[model samples]
Target: MITTFPIVALFILLGLAIPVGLVMALVGMAGLHSIGGWDMVSGIVQSTPLSTAGSYELLTLPMFLLMAEFVLISGVADDLFRAGAAWTGRVRGGLGMATALAGAGFGAICGTSTAAAATLSATTLPAMIKQGYRPDVAAGVVAISGTLSMLIPPSVALIIYGLIAEVNIGKLLVAGIVPAMIVTFTIIATIYVLVLRDPSVAPAGPAVPWAEKFRLLKVTGPVLLLFAFVTGTIYSGIATPTEASALGALAGFGLALSSGKLNLGTFRKALVRATYGTCMIMLIILGATIFGYYFALTQITQDLIIWVQGLGISPWIVMVMIVAFYLVLGCFMDQTAILILTVPVIVPLVVALGFDPIWFGVVMIVTAEVGLLTPPVGLNCFVVSRYSGIPLSEVFKGVLPHILAHLLALALIVGIPEITLWLPSHMN
Candidate 1:
């Protein structure tokens, strides 16, 4: 039944409150059943789960999630935010800048935007609000800043992209560094304008002594070390990305315990959180795998690609359209689901167009980041709204400027692919 056109059922199920994972899985099984009855379905079920679960690349997802869960459970995010606030708090638009900068640091702890936004909102929003920062600015900065993780090392989005596209995972991880830095700078620049236009929105904070500022880094040192440890091993070719993730998770756990921040209960909680998060991610992957199988059986993605190629449109035009599609999809869906669902179809088309996979990955991730800031279903914006009791309308208003800034940055990345590819090119 599903093989006739599983996609219709997919959306129908999605509309009916079916979980995305289960929906994909069901459509896939149904497609197989349509093809060869229960025999085909059973054969695929036996093969798919093991292949999906046993893949080495998939190992990174759980480890990354575990490391982040431990860090959040340990309350390291708070210390990291405080350290950032102390350093950048004194300048015009200081608190906002600090939020962006601090996000870069804490991005290492959480690779997903929602996790970072929630952690940041709980950690920094109250302080920003108390400091006379406008609620919208405070909430917007927290929400938008959460996107830093998309470009940061160990990014979940980048990992999944690399896995699906069969790109070099280590190189993709290295590739994200410069672009992430670029986005961070763009965000800070945006913050400056937002504050300058209305100082009342985010008045300058008190200046701190140089010694005190340096000391503040100490407060965030453990998490930073964990980041450095993971990235260093990956960049220097000392370990595989998989190895680095495991090491990083262990280091995160050790840091939490040694610092007396992780208790037995919290440790258990982190494990539970990590398990749930890992399961959520794995389920999505399982669904995507099944969906991809059904998609391949149909050859629809190939036909579409061939059709686009026949049109002789500039590959760049096609690329832009592909990104636009992502932006539109991002408005209504989670970034992860958007990326996973589209990758099977879109990536092959991108590869056929002669674009570098790593660069396209960065571009798509940036576009997805913009989606996180867009209206109606913007998860990060919703996170800010829930935390601050600000209406989504106001939160979206505050984030609109930043979304424009991200779009500008995305244009730069798309135009000059070097911005996204330079570091990975030189990677060991």
Candidate 2:
């Protein structure tokens, strides 16, 4: 009955369109007060926010967000898309492939999917449309491609997952590299197949001169070097994830400065945006921590795990059910909110089933990526539609195929845990 109240209240508050952090905090405090009166609630209210905000691991969030903001101001997204188009534009559906490639590259630097989607929509979507690509195809490609940021290194989602699940943030970030690459390729393949089926969807462009292609490629070097430096240092154990994030932020600022795109005003904007993003995530973490305390007090995770074990079903079936739950929940909730609300309950249950938390983190992210493209609250789709002037229906129409691509990638990761675990295991 105690657990039932909080869960029901959570749903009711969420349905009321309340901010996730406040909703969780209110329900949690109320639940705690119910369990142990105002004394417990007072103690929790005093300690939880400070502890959550003060985490060293949490520093990674703002640094990476700052890095991404600076990179956004740097005009790197435009360069990435142009460079990609130059190389791939002559092939059938080449521009769409270029969008995926550019999206992946931008995602390497920009950790947020909405930013990636908006950037691509502004840069690549127009180009694809002007090139006579089908609007739905173009919009779908842009929307789904943005999801790469959710799985790529320096991913904010994965970082938050690591913190909540109590896994190594460095290894968690490293584990995403291969899965991200596979997803990028899968998206590119999906585009190819789409064009193959209907050549009119993405008509090939005139070939780029070899010289011009090489010149365009040169512009991508710095971005690539920055990504390599950040991920490499972490993989080589030369820097902790937090150290790498600071270094990456420094590099991003340098790039923005060198490009002459970041002025005093832009610099201020970056800091403010980073600060705002950090505060938002911190609040979510704080509320989640409070709620997590209430949840732990209820002893529900242990009971749920025991009940599942006694069900006499295959663990894989249970895993599928969990994934389905995420997929459905994702349709209506923000990805970060989903992670904050569920990781505490799910991670322990997963570990009890003998699943790797690291691998499961990757799977969780991939599912979240899918959610970002699904309807009703497909954030990336809405971003694409808002930026590109595509109808909401068309944006959703376009993402259907890429959603399948995401599923295919998810299946591969789920079936072969090694795909996610291999690189992290070998990390120095």
Candidate 3:
């Protein structure tokens, strides 16, 4: 029944094209009836909102989201990306590479893939396109690079997964560091390769003087400081992730205000957008909780595990299969929705195989991050195309290399557990 519940719900969700949050609720409602009585369903409905909302840690979601909204609204991301581009534009494929690096830096505090996509596309894509970069390359770089927001610290997806899976949010946040860097650098390298092969795709911009580079560095310092505060405070045990997020949000707001960029209008818009985003996220969590409750009562997950173990297949094979499943599912579902829908089942299977919950969380996020660039429903790609006036087809073509780079990073994290584990362990 647990298995059938999700399968049936998947069809129901797609059939009606319902909002993800509602679909999760519907699935949960149906699964509950199959596993338990209406009383159980009632209990879930009553408990889930309070459970999801009561988390002090969740305070970070709105704070950090508001922070990013302010940055985008106030045009701070534009300044940072401009500074970065000015410094990096002299080299082969430099503008495109700068986009990825800037995205990473922005992701350090922003943590929202769509914000990164919209801001970076608005900030960098037009510049690169105007400067003679290939449309697909520009669009693809923005699309895939925006996904850095998911892999970096303070990622909303990671935080949500950690909360639901009962993993330590700090550990999940720490674990994301190496994987994020690996993906970011690999993307830059991919850009270099592409430009090197077809020089026409990226004509190098004129170099900025060292003094000007220093000037650009001055503009970028605040973002760097905010990034350090968010991650450093958490790793140093000086503050919880929630506290760090609050700090980051305040810092982002101050930075924008200090720059004379954020005003009454931007503040209002940021709050409204943050509230809407927070509501969407909370609703999804509530829905997943109900759905997961029903799935648990059915014991289908347990039965499937036993049946799979009966096959005498190694646990590693099962692990690989699950990762493969996420990659495929990513082609359709958004990362947050996928996490809410799958982690209840997947995390348990991963734990059964002796994988660290934190490590698996990182792996899950990275897999889902790839979905941000996957075709058809790839949100980041569409966002970039929208902002850059590039054809979606071109953005799809451009994202191919970055997609391969992400796949490689995913394989490494899967094969070597230490990469994700080292930081969290050392900090402890």
Candidate 4:
């Protein structure tokens, strides 16, 4: 009853339209009071926020967010899309493929999925639609492509998962590289197949001259260098993740300035936006910590682990069930809320079952990527739809095919753990 009450209340509060962080804190305090009175609640309420927000690792969040905001204001997404289209535009559904390619590149620097989706929708959707691409097909491709932001390095989602799961943040970031590449290509392939089956959905464009293609490629150099600088320092052990994020933010500022985009007004705007984003994430972390304390007091995770062990079931079966649970959960919850709420409970059970936490983190993230596209609360889909002024139904229709690509990517990562681990293992 103790365990069930908090979980049940959480859903009810969320369904009632309460903010996620407040709901978590309320349920947690109520549950703690039920178990250990106000003294326990008092002590936790005072400490959890400080401890959760005080970590040096937490600094990485704002820095990376600021970096993304600066990059967004710099107009790099347009450059990336133009370069991508120059190379891929001649092929059937080439513009769609180009959006995916550009999305992955932007994701490497941007990190947050919604921002990436909004930026791409604003920059690429009009171009695709202008080029005679089907609106639904173009919108769908933009929404799913934005999900790559959360899978690539500097990912805000991965950083939060690492902090909560007690895994190495650096390793978690590096681990995403290969799986992200696989998913990127999978999305591109899906676009090609869809265009092939129904050519009207995406018409091919005039081929670019080899000289113009090479010229356009130069626009990609600054983004590539920024990615290389950020990831290279982290992988080479030359800087901590926090240090890398700070440097990346500085590089982004420089990029914006060089492009004549940065001014006092734009700089202040980025700071304010990054500050707002950081505070929201920190509040969620604070609430999750308080809730985690109450959850730990209930001893549910330990009991669940023991119970599962005694079931005599194959571990893979258990793994599939957990993944399925996330898929359902993703349909309703935001990705950050899902991670902060569940990782505390799920990581221990996963470790007890002999799975690698790093591998599971990647799988969990890929699953979250799927959630970003699924209906009801598909955050990325909503962002794309709002930014592109497309109807929500068309955006949903567009993502149906890419959802299959996400599932295929998820299956490969789950079945072949090396796809996620090998690069991290090789990192210096």
lDDT tens digits by residue: candidate 4, 342-428 = 999999999999999999999999999999999899999999989999999999999999998789889989999988999889877
Per-model TM-score versus the true fold: 0.96, 0.99, 0.96, 0.99
Candidate 2 residue spans exceeding 4 A from truth: none
Error (Å) of candidate 2 at residue 249 is 0.5
The lDDT of model 4 is: 0.93
Per-residue lDDT over 1-428 for candidate 2, one digit per residue giving the tens place of the 0 to 100 score:
88898899999999988999999999999999989999999999998888888888888999999999999999999999999999999998999999999999998998999989998999999999999998999999999999999989889999999999999999999999999999999999999999889899999988999999999998899788889768989999999999999999999999999999888899999999999999888888889999999999989899999999999999999999999999999999989889999999999999999999999999999999999988798999999989999999999998899998789889999999999999999999
Better of 2 and 3 by TM-score: 2
- Superposition error at 409 for model 4 (Å): 1.3
lDDT of 3 by residue, 1-428 (tens): 35665667666776576877788787778777666668877887887888878988788788888887766755667777778788789987899888988899889878889989998888888889889988888888889889989889879989899878988888789889998988988889889889878999988999898988888788677877888778888898898888988888888888778878677888888899999999988888777777777677777679777777788888888889999998999897777778887888878877877889998998888888888888778989888888878888999999998899789889999999999999999874
lDDT of 1: 0.84
Residue pairs clashing, model 2 = none
Select the stronger candidate by lDDT from 2 and 3.
2
lDDT of 2: 0.93
The weakest ten consecutive residues by lDDT in model 1 span: 1-10
For all predictions, the C-alpha RMSD in Å is: 1.6, 0.8, 1.6, 0.9
Residue 396 Cα positional deviation in candidate 1, in Å, after optimal superposition:
1.2
